[model samples]
Target: MMRSNAAILVCVLAGSFVMAQEPDTKTLFKEFGRSVKSDDITLSFVLLNNRTVDVLFQAPGKYAVRARANQSTTFYVQGMPEKDMVVDTKFFVEQDGHTYEASSLNIKNFDGNTVTKGTRVDGMIQLGTKLDLTHPFTVRGSHGSVEFVLSPEALKLAEPAPAAAPPPE
Candidate 1:
């Protein structure tokens, strides 16, 4: 009876460990856009992870992506303001059987000076001459990469408004 009880206890503890080791698949949603003098577009989507991220793309420029993980820290440099850390900084989009890459660097100040060392890297790269967010794409950086799929719900978010009915007759 004693040996049987010990075996049962071991099995219970093992099961608990396994359950704790499983990764959590949390989802996050964000939508934002801005215009500086030209046409602007707003993008919204669901991320597969719980990390907070911002995706920005200028009409005639490149895309700037930032992400923060659980272990990120906010700190201030000697002469600079507080900043958050980011990890594994890179971005890539796969469309029409072609892959485009963007290089990322550590976040800097307006004068091109490094503020605080962060796990997240920030940089801009030319996205060619077209911008297509309809297709699925992935954003990768120091922390890691996440693939975003345009679900039916996301499609609705990207839809255009209906035309006016003949100027109300």
Candidate 2:
């Protein structure tokens, strides 16, 4: 009985040590939405391993996502009900072995149903980088500001690789 107890304790300790060495990779998924008059606007996102990000936007029953060749992506939202609305957006991304900020995105809604947009840049900043799903950002409009964060257990989708050039004939 004593031997069995000792073995069990050792195994538990070893397992804990091994788990500590592993990277803290958390998946995230989140959604935010609101109704304006008869229109509805929503934003959803999924992030994995700080490597991949997928964002979906819905406005007045219309849904769309932003995708690109490189790590950077841009998305636009239209059909807002309030004119003279100001939209503020911010986010972060890793680039050139460093992190950079893509913030202070203020959009003026001249028309009541103007289009607003956001962007995420990940790798090479000059060319643009992927979105940093780890950090939280805010989208402020006439109604109010909606904050977005990564959800636990988010899908882990690998980024698509760039197409290779054809070999010389």
Candidate 3:
């Protein structure tokens, strides 16, 4: 009887494992990055921890971010309901017929634990936080956090300050 019970328990656990929902972190991150770079705009995302709001990015920059509890959406205008709290910023890139944007930060697994890439010369970067775009950086937030940024090249065009009106009207 004990043997049969053990077998049944093993089978149940195996079944659960097979049915479990596990996110593909690598693919998700890559996709996020690609999307950001493909579009020249800043986007926003909501961090979710334990099925509750963790943090909110006023505006997600231009890149991509994938964490355990985060999702993102992009919009072109305002007055629309906040879908996941999307915000547009002055950061983004356009290339190969697509636009890419910045993310608040990029976090990934490092040394068997999650680590933010602070600022790097040839790696990902955190979205909203400022950094040298030519250089690279990444940020990790509590629960789940990710934002996008614009490449320096794209930022120049994306951010078009109106010409000063001759000092005064």
Candidate 4:
């Protein structure tokens, strides 16, 4: 009788495992990318390590990204500032044919001269902006690919900034 019970338990556990492994990366990203183009795109989800965060260009130089998390759960808000400089810098969307210069962005508490020291060996960009919850971003790095997701709302929060300069002669 005991042997029979043990076999039943093993089968049950195996069935549950099969059910757990759902949503392959390719399928997940395809759905996520489509949502971004929707009129109302508000999302909040977590990701695990080594997952692929791929962004396919929809328009000329315009990109739509589907970033998968690496081994942890991170938050996303549209227009919100990115905490990890290297990860945040990756999203340099070139709109309207003008190459947006990174140097032109003035973030609070950031000394432009010292910013380079903070660049990750993998080339993460440092960005400072008002914490706009409406535009929250989630791009976590793990394994080879970092997952990137954009929030639908337009989140906002003020950042510390440098003092304005005096008029030149």
Candidate 5:
């Protein structure tokens, strides 16, 4: 009985993925992505939520940094170094007069030896503070920072999905 129930649950989850009819999946992310030039690096950020963001690093060339989490879930960046650069900085966000920092950062994929260029890593920082997207926010790093003011379209985006719990009054 338990096995059959689990199977049904899996089917329901799988069906959600298969049921996505929107060809432009990027629409969900378009509202949360933004970029700026910070010193030599052109940093971009995508806000997945208050605590989550994706970051990207690019060099002299133009690259589309998709918003999802890896640091673009990670935001996107342009102007990565000509050669590979080491990931040596921390990331943070300043919102509503508070500064929140990244608990962990994964970059320069850790190989057996040194980190390789374009190496991907995963580490998310979630704190007790809930993100209030109504106000403008900033993503800061050792390199520089990016400021983002949510747009009117973001009103719907600001609200959590229906399944999420209600915010504290």
Candidate 6:
């Protein structure tokens, strides 16, 4: 039987490796980074599982909220020690003339109707399944937008190397 994901996490944390039911997910973090800027706001994305993206927004502090994406939403707000602040404005993406809104399951800093600000980024955002990384895509919000394509170097970094064979008993 397949081990539970929590069990797998614990085994990995103990410095022992647990082979996955699938070969491709052997690495801890299977993701690639892409970033862009709109005005003074910079947004970075790590496509964590092709569809799940961690969006990091950096901007001036004491900012107000705005719309960034459409559809069901979950937001995260974190305050950096460096005074950098982030607010997840509802965001939307336009690709191939169709609009796709990020669906997030994040409840980290949620406070009733607001996602309370803390010290981090949005680990939510379920990107569109049809998100094309090979081509340029744009992410837009109330302030501005950024357009970018996945870089070959960045993609290469996301490729998982095979795990080492277990040591002698």
Tell me, by TM-score, which candidate is best.
5
Poorest 10 consecutive residues by lDDT, candidate 3: 47-56
lDDT winner = 5
lDDT of 6 by residue, 29-114 (tens): 22344454544344454444321221233243112211232222222322212233344546677677777786544434322133
Better of 1 and 5 by lDDT: 5
Question: Which ten contiguous residues of candidate 1 have the minimum total lDDT?
Answer: 34-43
How well does each candidate superpose onto the true structure, as a TM-score? 0.34, 0.30, 0.22, 0.22, 0.51, 0.43
lDDT against the true structure, per candidate, is 0.35, 0.36, 0.31, 0.29, 0.49, 0.44
lDDT, candidate 2, equals 0.36
Better of 3 and 5 by TM-score: 5
Better of 2 and 3 by TM-score: 2
Residue 93 of candidate 2: its Cα lDDT? 36
CA RMSD (A), model 4 = 19.9
Model 4: residues >4 Å from true position, as ranges?
Answer: 1-5, 8-18, 33-50, 53-169
**What's model 3's overall lDDT?**
0.31
Task: Encode model 2's per-residue lDDT on 1-105: one tens digit a residue.
Answer: 999999999989988986674334342122222222322333222322223323222343222122332334332333332333332234343433454554322
True-vs-predicted CA distance for residue 58, candidate 4, Å: 27
RMSD, every candidate, angstroms: 18.3, 14.0, 21.1, 19.9, 11.0, 12.0
Candidate order by decreasing lDDT: 5, 6, 2, 1, 3, 4
Candidate 4 residue 105 Cα shift, in angstroms, is 21
Per-residue alpha-carbon lDDT of candidate 3 for residues 1-169, written as tens digits (9 for 90 to 100):
9999999999899778754633244422332343221122222232122211111222242212223223332222111112222222233433334444544222322112222333111223223323333333322222222444545533342232345358454
**Judged by lDDT relative to the true structure, which candidate is superior, 2 or 4?**
2
Model 2 misplaced regions, further than 4 Å: 1-70, 80-129, 141-143, 155-169
- The CA lDDT at 69 in model 4 is 25
Model 1 TM-score (2 dp): 0.34
